[model samples]
Target: MSSATGPEEPDFPAATAARLDGLGLLDTAVTTCRACPRLVAWREEAARVRRRAYRDWDYWARPVPGFGPPDAPLALVGLAPAAHGANRTGRMFTGDPAGDVLYAALHAVGLASRPTSVHRGDGLELHGVRITAPVHCAPPENRPTPAERDTCRPWLARELTLLQPALRAVVVLGGFGWQALLPVLRDAGWELPRPQPVFGHGAEVTLRHTEPGRELHLLGCYHPSRRNTFTGRLTPAMLRAVLARGAGLAGVPCRWRPGTPDT
Candidate 1:
């Protein structure tokens, strides 16, 4: 994950270690994360500051891990852990207002089976979508430094490989995610001369990767962060439209009959 989308040395080994189940890999990664000391400190501080809200809540005191159905084909790349969101819940896109809207949209589109994402314990699942972040640790002000992104990418690379053999399209949430994903595409020898056009809401750019010569459809969207939604920077329909386009690009059929609600 290069900061400014510059080509970097490929860190993904020709092959990764034996792939483990999704949950098992997530668990191990969380335990071994030491890429950024600042993020770890910030996450701990956020938890302590909001300790009252989580007095009875079991705070997962480690880098939040991504979670989804084990065999999902689509990977959702979010920016980073929000201070009170994944940083507190120890799961990507969980325990936050943003997740409420995201999970609902997923359910509407028939990708997620659950309507609410209360916490990691809630039995929410995705049919084809798996979520991960550019950085595992929660950074100060929710903004990760370039050093942090570069340092932590090994985890992301590993997660991608583990989820692979099934990975198809990846949806990057914002510019940061798009930047992080660029090196990944480059490593696979899929670098475009002109950087892929970046715009919020489902902009589909074809990614060229060799070895298997798969065309990975890259979709972009505004992150479901409180700063964007609470201030009305992004509308619910706008977000849904992006997801809908992504579903179409991924060849997921729409089942919203005239008389039926999206759910």
Candidate 2:
């Protein structure tokens, strides 16, 4: 019953800030992005149609911003938001099956305050971790075309640039994210290895920072989507192992102790 508008380009800040204000400004701008016409249409339609189960819920219907502490040492990148998941809940990986596996593993590894992320204001907290995506909007069929991904890249680039000072490691959820993120990392002053590392479960690559005395570690993990989880391509143990390894490389303590049983 509601009418949706076409996509509008975002107005980036004239200059990037070095502290939290910069991140805050960029996040606000991310939520307002409407650069991809197809994505804007799809996201608005999904919100307007309203899933029968969530008929009473109001959809965010905007670009989903990255979620986590500004100074997080570990950054987790995913492909994009789910139409009925983040699009409905306004938070990355919330109200979805993939989030169920992800938050559980994060909790088990002690990076998350809780084992679940049901909604945006559910008191869930991420310690030394921030979850984001290459594309901010929910796309039809969960796939954003190459043009859409490229159009949405500047937001991720700015976020990483702002986070570089504190970021020591990154965990890419799937091949899409791994590929999308490498260029951003390179532009942010990381010296990526030649031939570029391929994405695989538990794959690790270390890169030297352009800034002296700093380095970054990149870890690849199978996305916690139903396709992978249902097929056993990614197990709880496998996900936890990658998270623990990433934390170690980032020089952060894993809350989940060794031999801790999975929830």
| Candidate 1, position 135, lDDT | 83
Please report the candidate that would top TM-score against the real structure.
Answer: 2
TM-score of each: 0.83, 0.92
Ten-residue segment with the worst summed lDDT in candidate 1? 6-15
Candidate 1 segments whose C-alpha is farther than 4 A from its true place: 1-23, 253-263
Each candidate's number of clashing pairs is: 0, 0
Task: Kindly list the per-residue Cα lDDT of model 2 for residues 22-85, writing each as its tens digit.
Answer: 7788888788767788999999999999889999888988989999999999999999999999
Cα lDDT tens digits, model 1, 157-217, are: 6677676667767888888998897776676556555755665566778876666567777
What is the lDDT for 222 in model 1? 86
Model 1, 120: alpha-carbon shift in Å?
0.9
